[model samples]
Target chain A: MRKQHWIEVGVGAFMLFGIVALIFLALRVSGLTLDRNEPSFTLTASFSNIGGLKPRSKVTLAGVVVGRVTDIQLDTKWYEAKVTMSLEQKLEGLLSTDTSASILTAGLLGENYIGLTVGAETDVLEDGDEIRDTQSALVLEDLINKFLINSTKD
Target chain B: MIGLDSLARLGRAGLALMAALGRSGVLFFQAVWGWPSGQGVKLWMRQVHFIGVLSLIIIVVSGLFIGMVLGLQGYSILVGFGAEQALGQMVALSLVRELAPVVAALLFAGRAGSAVTAEIGLMKATEQLSSMEMIGVDPMRRIIAPRLYAGFVAMPLLTAIFAAVGILGGMLVGVDWLGVDEGSYWGTMQATVDFRADVINGMIKSVIFGLVVTWIAVFQGYDLVPTSEGISRATTKTVVYSSLAVLGLDFILTALMFGRI
Candidate 1:
């Protein structure tokens, strides 16, 4: 009976240790912060071309991550990509209505993310408001083609 | 005449293999027909202690060493490309997505699976299982079901532990010894390794491996011929078949989950 009791304790401890390990894997290794419930608001941007931008890609302000791209879809009527972003609530009333959004690539051959540049207008954009100014992803192929054509003509 | 005799032997072997597969499938269903009741829970715990707790040391030790080796090798290779920062991503992804579950399952097969087979096979060889049958107690219910349940629960946890420990080991080597930037090591890993795709898929693999290993172990034990040589053969078969099944199923599962088709 005593041995059985000890075995039960060991089993219980082993299971508890396993759960701890799973939580570590989820939070630390996999980087699942589970912070989606934090206060944030949605905003949208339209781009002619998003390139390799994906949902969950970081939205950065001056190289600091301020939000994440929550959804990306094509606006069939406008014939452009509609991107929805969730920003920190602390940024509310800070970003002006005329702020510009551009898809930017990280490093060379790295992932593409959204970069935000502040605007000077006093009126700030609110949740679900779409930014008007946008720059499409710079396709390297297009740049190479133009460079090759200009050099050949010279 | 010789060709005919060889053909007849082949047919018999094929029939035996089919019969064994069918019996094992039925045995799995019978063993897992329902959830454990009040008294069955204790037996389940005991099995967990026997199988899971006993196997922890091997899993952790091997995980640490394997992770350190990955870190060392990854750094040497990535340094040439000036991509040492990606070491964390490489280690975590490989461990979480593939190595942790598959290696842990193989070890579990060798250690716990073989042990379960030998114990049950010995019981059969000694007529203990038959004695329980004569006494109106179902050995399958009391003995086999609890072990199978414990195995199903233990495997995923063990795999998780293995991944967690392996990551730590990699960090120890990559960050502490190798002088890779700690922030980039962890940050890039976090950015790249998706929780749903990598971690959850690995967990799914572990669960499937658990089912295969335990099912093979219990079936091999129960179906063995009641003799010393039979028990030895059953134990060997448990390890061999469980390893093969885990590896083959891993490939199929990986293709289904990550093939993006």
Candidate 2:
């Protein structure tokens, strides 16, 4: 019985260690970084609907994550979700005065993401500037319900 | 007159079946909820020792091989499309969403479920459960509850083990074996695969599967006759029912989550 107990303990310890190690390795390999190299700037995007949008969501420009959503606040003035994004230093120069931010899907049924369309204007938008012309995501369920409702009328 | 009597008997039978099902459902929930009490904790730990710790090596080894195979297969397919970077996302999503939970549940049912059925069957044969009842003890709250709770807790932990090991296996093939850049593999996964809902869905499925497997095993065991043949039949039923329930529950969960018909 003593021998059996020892064996059990050994096995349990090994499994616990192995699982923890694997999770640590996965997190490390996934490039989950906290250190910032360049001066970070914040910009706000207001959307009528930020469906399932949460802080720490990636802010993508041309499908690449340039920053992350830092804060999401309800704008009482406009009754919209004001999403504040922290842009990485390297991508700061691309945020022009005419740049447009839109809430879009990564793929069909995928999570909602912020997509930045680089503007042609030469002047870069300063920090804290709002990207006012933002498009909200077209929720698929709502669209389907609308289509079904509309089609029944005819 | 005879036809009317027969109709009444059929209606009574239907009502009985409905009552049995309703009682089982309520009992299952109560067992699950009452599992965190002091005695329940000890039972849960024992189950963790048996199910999670005992099955770790097998789960990890299988998970690693599955991950490696997925990486090799995904790499080949993506290379054909000239999109090798997507391999990480493919492996991560498949492992987390499907393979890990199903495989872990199947293994748990076979290893732990069978043992539970046999143990309870032996107790029933020896009149141990009857003795408990005579002594004013509730077997459902005491014996069955702990086993069910243990299973519920163990399944998710085991699933996590499977997912973690599978990812490592993919990383080994993508980085060390195939000479692909480690950064890109991890980068693609972080960018595409890791979602909050994926983890939640996996855990929820695992917990439900665990409860079903344990409940079926205990129910069969408690209903077993005293003969050796009855024990054998109980064991067989336990495994068969557990596996079917796991698969059936997985289908329901997947449909509900993805909202596909």
State which candidate has the highest TM-score. Answer: 1
Tens-place lDDT per residue, model 2, B14-93, is 99778756766776777666655765565556666776677777887898999999999989888887678678888887
Tell how far residue A85 is off in model 2, in angstroms.
Answer: 5.4
Shift in Å, residue A119, candidate 2 = 9.7
Best by DockQ: 1
Question: Ten consecutive residues with minimal summed lDDT in candidate 1 chain A?
Answer: A28-37
Over 4 Å off in model 1, which ranges? B1-7
DockQ (0 to 1) for model 2: 0.17
TM-score of each candidate structure, all chains considered together: 0.95, 0.70
True contacts kept of each: 0.89, 0.13
What's each prediction's clash count? 0, 0
> For model 1 chain B, where is the 10-residue window of minimal lDDT?
B29-38
| Model 2 regions lying over 4 Å from their true place | A1-65, A68-154, B1-23, B26-30, B33-40, B135-137
- Per-residue CA lDDT of model 1 for B1-261, tens digit only, reads 999999999999999999998999888888997456788899999999999999999999999999999999999999998999999999999999999999999999999999999999999999999999999988888889999999999999999999999999999999999999999999999999998999999999999999899999999999999999999999999999999999999999999999983
What are the clashing pairs of model 1? Answer: none
The DockQ figures for the candidates are 0.84, 0.17
